[model samples]
Structures are given as structure tokens and as C-alpha cells.
Target: MEFVPEEGKHLHEDCSTLILPALSIGNVGQLVADLLISSMGSERVGYLDDPNVLPCVGNDAYGPFPQGDLALPLEAYDSPSNALTIIQQRSPVVKGMMIEFAKNMADFLAGSGKKHIVVLSSLDFGKWQKVDMSSGLQIYYLSSSNSNGTDENCEQLGWKKLQEYDPSQMHWKYLSDLAEGNVTVEDITSVEDELEEENYYASLPFAALFSFLKAKGLKVTCLLCYCSEGDNISDAFQLGDAVCKLLQLSHPTTGIEGGKWRVPLSWMSVYGPPPDVSIF
Candidate 1:
């Protein structure tokens, strides 16, 4: 849960907003993070040193060629001009260690003087019940600053507030209790073992992160969409666009496809090497 800055590189002092991806359906959040980092040309500032996350390493995800830069399980990038600090997660937390991870992250960000957090994630489209077709690709949001209603800006942006977030409900209350340090993981496990009700939000990593960050008195907003597992690059672009609009970040005009965004070179083989042309 400690932050290890790269040699001669440190967290941006002016960056107050932290954009993070909650490893969820389609890994849309991570993809959006990739888009933001690549397009913005953000610099890697530091990485999280925590044992709770499963270890992972791979080629640098942004470069056009193999630069020998290793991508770790959790790394932080800073965009000073945009006043943003984005965290890119390439691995999931260890089983039963989510709460501890969330707590540590909340503490770390709070101590780091972060003022706002924007969490990007996705929902299972099969589980989503679309009620309004007119809205078109509904983006649902849950914010600590606007729990009772939608934020005016978000409303203007055509994003809907998550309606299922009732803290009074038993399943949701359990998470709040846990985030506030009033309940332990064992207590929750025992309670959940007795309950037969299945709660979707309670099971996602975003829920824990949101609750913990909110408990730390930081503004947290979760932007979510509904999509199933498949090629979700388009979903990532849409979410990335929404985030840019939400944060008022100026889109760099040097990217591909009319310069709206710069697609990472690592994405060239996203689906894996043209199906081995020799086999065709």
C-alpha cells in the first residue's frame, strides 16, 4: 500500500484528481485508462507496492515498439497540464483481500492530498434492464457528492444516476459498514453466508473503492456502462470521451482517426496476431 516513485520522478504536486479503473466487466476502465495515458502523453510517476494484488508484468502498453519498459500490476501516471493522476491496474487483488486493498488505497490517496476520484467501470449488460432507449447507451453514475440525485453537470452530459444504490438496504449497508471500519471482513463473510440474496453492486471492486474513498471524505464518482465480454474497444472510447468531457480535459488532436484520440500501438494486437495468417 506504499507508493514507490520512479527514479527522479514523483507525483505531480498540482494534480488533485485521480482517475482509476475498477477491474470489472470487459476491463473497460483499464482500457479507458490506457487511452487517457497514451493520448495525454502522461508520465509514469510511481507504482503501488502492495502484496495484496496479484503479480503481473508485460510489455509497455503505450509505445509503438518494445521499449523494454515493464508494466506492473499497479502503476500511477501524472498529467500535470490536465491536473490528473491516473492509476492503471493490470491485475486483480488476491482473493478475500479486497477490503484491505481498498482501505490502503483510500489512506494513500487521502494522505497524498487528492481531492477527487473518478472511477471507471462497467456492468454486465445481460443484467442491465434498459428502460429508456431514447437516452442511448446509458451511462450510470454513482457519486459521493450527489447521492440523492444526479449531478447537474452529469445530467447535462446525459449520464444517469445509479438508482440501485440504497445504503439503507442490508446488502448495501454491509459495504458501508465495512468501509467505515465498523465491520470486519470475517463479520461480512459470516453475514453473507447466511444471506441468500445476490447483490451485484456489492460484489464489484468499485463498490468497495467508492465506499472507502468516500469514507475518507474525498469526492468519488463512478461512471459505469453496460456491456458483455467481447471486443469492447468501442466501449472504452465512449467512456474515455465521457471522462474527457467530465474533467474538461482538452483532447489532443494528434491521434489517429481524425485526431479524436490516440490509440496505443500496443492495441495493434489486442485480439492477438491476425489469427496466425499461416493457419488461414
Candidate 2:
């Protein structure tokens, strides 16, 4: 619904595989983007860049607000989604430009004849940890499912994303008694819960997009690589690893030459300082 039909340009010959990552809080999406870019390269994958347009129903920032500029909209970087409080050494990556670019990419994937789209992500769950920031998070496997739950997605492509989370297994809740202090302990847990939920919802946009794709009969697969809540994990590294796994999962044994169709080559331009694959 958000995307306009036949708005995106064709980047590849045909059937270009797409991988979209969340690229926010947990860095799972960013990690996936980095990995796909590194694997695909720039020349091969075309970046979907769309001009400024009035939003479908929301503001250029997080979501549609009641009021504020409806005419001559501002650039995406100026939106609230890009605004971060400077928590540590990071800033919000999902802003106006990134989002529109993603939309254009969706247009390309849908109309450009590429039926397969894969979105990569990393997330956190509330699991108690002893040392704090050293807990391992559970990784979830969510595949897109159609209304019938038995379309081509299930038969050929294997679509099945909507799965219930087992709080007992996936939810990691730290006991309050183990807190370092009354203030720090409660603060940590609350922060963890917020991050966990945010990461989970971050994947929703892609899910929504995939659902849209399904309406058009396009097959979309979302691969999420979860990170532990407090392990001080490298989301970037995990993304790369996830990319390799996704590629393998989509197709077994056949390397890139085998027509596995890795992500388009836009990695170098956007995600700079590529990870030393050896380092991962």
C-alpha cells in the first residue's frame, strides 16, 4: 500500500533477490545489510533512491502524527526517526532517506520482476544474565505466511514467518534480586525490555511490506539473526554470518556461481568499512 506500482527502476536482468535489514537498535538489520552489501557488491545491486513525496499517512519520522508539514516536506535526515539521544557511540540509522530508499527498493522488487525478497534482522530477548550485558539472546525463525498459509510461499519458497514467541523459551528475564543496585538493576531490566520490543517491532515494517508483496504475489523471506541482550555482541559480525546462512538456507551447496543470486552490489557505497570476513 505504501509503494507505488511501477515506480522503481530495474537494476538487474531479472529476479533480483532482495535482503532488507532493520538497521536500528539491535543492529541486526544493519548487520544484515552490511553482509549482503559485502557479498553482492555495488555495481551489481542498484540502490533504490526516491524523491521526496508526501507521506502515505504518517510523518517522515516514526509514524504519521496528527499535524506538521504536509507540504514541501523536509529531507529524511531531518526527521525524528533519525534523531538519537547519543546513548554511546551510535546514531539512529533508519531515517527518511533510508526508509524511502527501502520503499523504492520494494517497488523495484515487486514490479521489476524479482519475486524473491529477503529481509535480514537481529533482535534481543529478555533473558537473565549473571554478569549483565553478557546474556545470550534467542534467535527466532519467522517466515512470511499468506492468508491461505498454503500459497506458493509454502510450496516452492517455503513461506512461514508468523510464529508465536514462546516466552518461556525466547523471553529472557533477569531476576531482580541479582541487580547490582536498586537503581541500576531496575534500570537495566527496563532498558532491556524496551530494546527487545523495539527490535521485534522494527521487523514489522518489513513484515508489512512482505504482506503487501504477497498481495501482489511476490515471495518474500525475512531472516532474523538475534543477538543476546547483554553480551556486548557485534551485530555487524552476526549480520555477515546471517547473510552466509541465509544464502545457504535459500539454496543448499550451490555457491554464488551456481546461480544462488546473492544480494545486489550496493554494500561498499552505503555500509563503509566492510567487516574483515576473516575477522568474523
Candidate 3:
């Protein structure tokens, strides 16, 4: 993997944080990265180009308005004022290359003098069944072995770590038995047991990143949400808000009635009004 800077540009800076997304359920991480880049008005800093990764090209998602103009697939951005840098992957990495990519990314970040790394991700909601939708959304953090300061800050802010579960444990067996019996929804105790089991069984991409960071003794933290597969725009918004609070990024209050979070201009046509169809 190679990072190619834009013409006449230098990436070295006193960057305090490096933010990126891990491709996971609901694409929540990618959406959060998009929100950060657009809301912060970050500029194109560079890009990661590698043959092992899938190639992608599309119009700038954060453009002033949605258009067909083109941009790189994996681009980097920086907000000097906030002392933050962002790496947004518009597409997923090719299969079998995640470990290599993660290692390269860790090396790049470690050499950048950045103090923190934040990865936004999501987990499968079906694995657990006790979602308290009325209590507002919940987000959890996982700090790297070297991130004591980050862990303390999260604790001070009252953020909880995600409850882990071992897939091979009795809890999972019980859940499986229940499922076989057509009992999709179990008792609260069973659900709690399922959700609270302590284990790390993240997807390959996330695991790769964590492994690389741990091997290099780098400080990193991950903010994650429980999500199901589908149109998860709401999940994305909630996670975005959590990240904003954690980083103190400028953000408005939640709720569409109150004021919705700013979505990228490129999403305007995501569902399509058809290029020929007009509301005018």
C-alpha cells in the first residue's frame, strides 16, 4: 500500500487525531466518515492507492451540490484548525488484502505523529434482542492497549464498552436452540446473557486493524453501534452524533423536527428521482 499526496502537498502535521471507517454492518463507519469530512469542510489531502484494493471513482460526496463530477476512491482530508485528519474509503478493500492494508495504514499513522485514532464501526443487531429504542441510541468504545488516556476520557464521559460474546459458548448454543424452536425473541435474561458475554469476534477488517495497532503498540479507539442490515440512515446519524460529542466537533441537536445532521450533497440522488424526473 502506498499513500500518494496531492501535487505540491505535504502530509506531515501536528495532527492530534486520525479518523477512518471500518466496513461493517450497515456501513455505519463510512457514513460517519462522510459526515465528518463534509461538516468539517475538510480538503483533499492525499489518497491510498494499492493494486490489492478495489478501484473506485465517483463524484465528490461532499460537494457544494450533488453532481456527476469525479473524485478519487480513497481520499484523505484534513482540518488544520481542529488538528484532525480523516481518511475516507469510498469503497471496500478487495478481499484477501485487509491485513496488508491494515499494516500499511498502521505504519503510516504511526509515522504521522498523531496522538489518537478513532474507528467507527457497527455490529449485527440480530445476535442480541434487547434493544431499548426508547432510551435513545447507545454507542460503545474499545480502546487499544496503548490508549489509557483515551480510555480514561471515555470513562469520564460515561461511555460504555461494547459487551462481547463468544460464538462457541453456551450462550450462543442456547440462542441457537431457541432459534431452532422458532423462538426468535427470548427472555430478558437470555438476551442479556447473549449480549454481555465477553469476547472479541469482530469482522475481519476490524480485526486486522486492531491486530496491526496492537502489534505496533499504537493508541487507537473504536466507537461502535449495534445495527441490522438495511437502509440505516438513522443509525448513521446517531453514530455521527456520538463521534461529534467525543471529538467536540461542531454539531446540531438531534431529531428531524429539532434539526437533522447535515448529510453529504452526493446523497441527494442516492435513491434517485431519476435524472429525467423533476419536482419542479
Candidate 4:
């Protein structure tokens, strides 16, 4: 991975937090990162160029005005006021290269001296039937073994750990059900075990990232929101608010209470009204 820093600007060596998002279900994590980049007035400090990442180009998502200027697929930002460095990943890693991408990211963080890494992500509710989706939304956390204060921080913020599933038990139940329907015991035993030993309840990038971080003993924390696949603006807003609370970026006196998370102007054209259509 190659980092191209902005001309005449460099990342703060002492930046404490590294905030990023894994491209997950509903795109909630990316949206939350967008809100942070806009709300915190973060600047593009650099761009990461890696062969493992898919190529993408688009207008800046947090621009003050629609200038039609193009942006890189992966850009990095810094919020000095918050003492945080943010990574805005607009695309997913190329297929089969997730492991390589995670390794490069781990190397970058290890060399950057950042103390904490926070990943905003989402998980599919359908895979885990136990997830309570009646409340419309819920945020959970999973921290690496080396997480210094992330566990305490989540507790102080009242966030819960994502429910874990026992793959062995689940697999056994499935095998038993198949056996009752004329399936032979030998056939069931012959089936390769598809269950993972540790299920973080996350999709590809987030799960791969967590594995890499844990193996390297890096202090990484993942904040996940349970969501369905649809117009998930509400999910993104809730996730943004959760991160805001965790980072103490909101003010009680600013009228930025519940359900009032800030939205960037770039989202106005997200669905596109077509080039011929203009709003007066």
C-alpha cells in the first residue's frame, strides 16, 4: 500500500485514534465515517493506493460545494481538534485480496504509533436469528485482546458485546435435522465442517480485519450495528450517534440530541435526480 500525503501537510505522529469503516451490510459503516469527516471538518491528509483495493473515482463526499472534482477510492483524514485520524474507504477490497489488504493496514497502524483503532461496521441480522431487531436498531462492540481501554469505554457508553453463536451446536442441529429426512450418518460426518471457531458476527472485511489485528496484538475495536438490507439511513444515523457518544464529540447544549445526527450535504444527490433534473 502506498500513502500519498497532501502536499505541505503530514499526519500528526501522536494522533491517538484511528477511525475507519469496513464495507459491510447496508453500508452503515461508510456512512458513519462520512458524517465524522463532515461534522468534524476533517481534511484529506493523504490517499492510500493499494493493488488489493478496487479502483474507484468520485466527487468528494464531504465537499462544501458540489465542485465536480474527483476523489480517490481510499483517502485519509485528520481531525486535530479530536486528536483522531480517519480513513474514508469508498470501495471494497478486490476479491480474494482481503487478507493482504488487512495486513497492509496493520503495518500502517503499527508504524503510525496510533494507540487506538476503531472500526465502524455492520452485520446481517438474518444470519443470527437471536438478534433483536424489534427496537429498529442496536449497536454492539468487539474488542481485540490488546484493547487498552476500549472495553471500559464501551461499558461507560452502555454498549453491549454482540451475542456469540456456538457453531458446533448449530452445526449438530442442522446435521440431526438432515438425518431425520433419510440422510445417512456417514454422509453427515463426511460433510466438511463449515463452522468457524470464532464468529465475530461480521462479514468479510470486518472479520478479516479483526483476525489480522488480534494476530498482531494490535489494539482494535469494532462497533457494529444490526441492520437489514434496505434504505438504512436511519441505521447510519444511529451508528453515527453511537460513535459521537463514544468519542464525546456531541454537545448536550447544541440541540444535537437523539435522532438529530448531522448529515453531509453531498448526500443530497446520492440517489440522483438525473442530470436534466434541477432543483430550484
Give the number of the best model, judged by lDDT. Answer: 1
> What does candidate 4's lDDT look like per residue over 1-280, in tens digits?
7888899888877568888899988888888888777777677888999898889898757666767756788888888777889888888898756656877887777777778788888887776656566765777887764233147778777777755522135443333233233343355444333433323342257755665555555677888887778777888878887877777775333224353545677788777665564653
Q: How much is the lDDT of residue 7 in candidate 1?
A: 98
Q: State candidate 1's TM-score.
A: 0.93
Q: Is candidate 3 or candidate 4 better by TM-score?
A: 4
Which candidate model has the greater TM-score, 1 or 2? Answer: 1
**Local distance difference test values of all predictions, in order:** 0.86, 0.38, 0.68, 0.70
Which candidate, 3 or 4, has the higher lDDT? 4
Name the lDDT value of residue 249 in candidate 4: 70
| lDDT tens digits, residue span 150-191, model 2 | 334333333233343322222212211121122333444445
lDDT value, residue 155 of candidate 3: 74
Compute each candidate's TM-score over C-alphas: 0.93, 0.44, 0.76, 0.78
TM-score of 3: 0.76
lDDT of 2: 0.38
Q: What are the root-mean-square deviations of the candidates from the true structure over C-alphas?
A: 2.2, 15.0, 9.8, 8.4
Residue 168 in model 1: lDDT: 76
Top-TM-score structure, candidate number: 1
- Which digits, one per residue and each the tens of the lDDT, describe model 3 over residues 208-251? 57546555666778888888887778888888888777888654
After the best TM-score superposition of candidate 3, give how far the Cα of residue 54 lies from its true spot, in angstroms.
0.5
Candidate 4: C-alpha RMSD after superposition: 8.4
Model 1 RMSD to the real structure?
2.2
How far is 266's C-alpha from truth in model 3 (Å)? Answer: 1.1
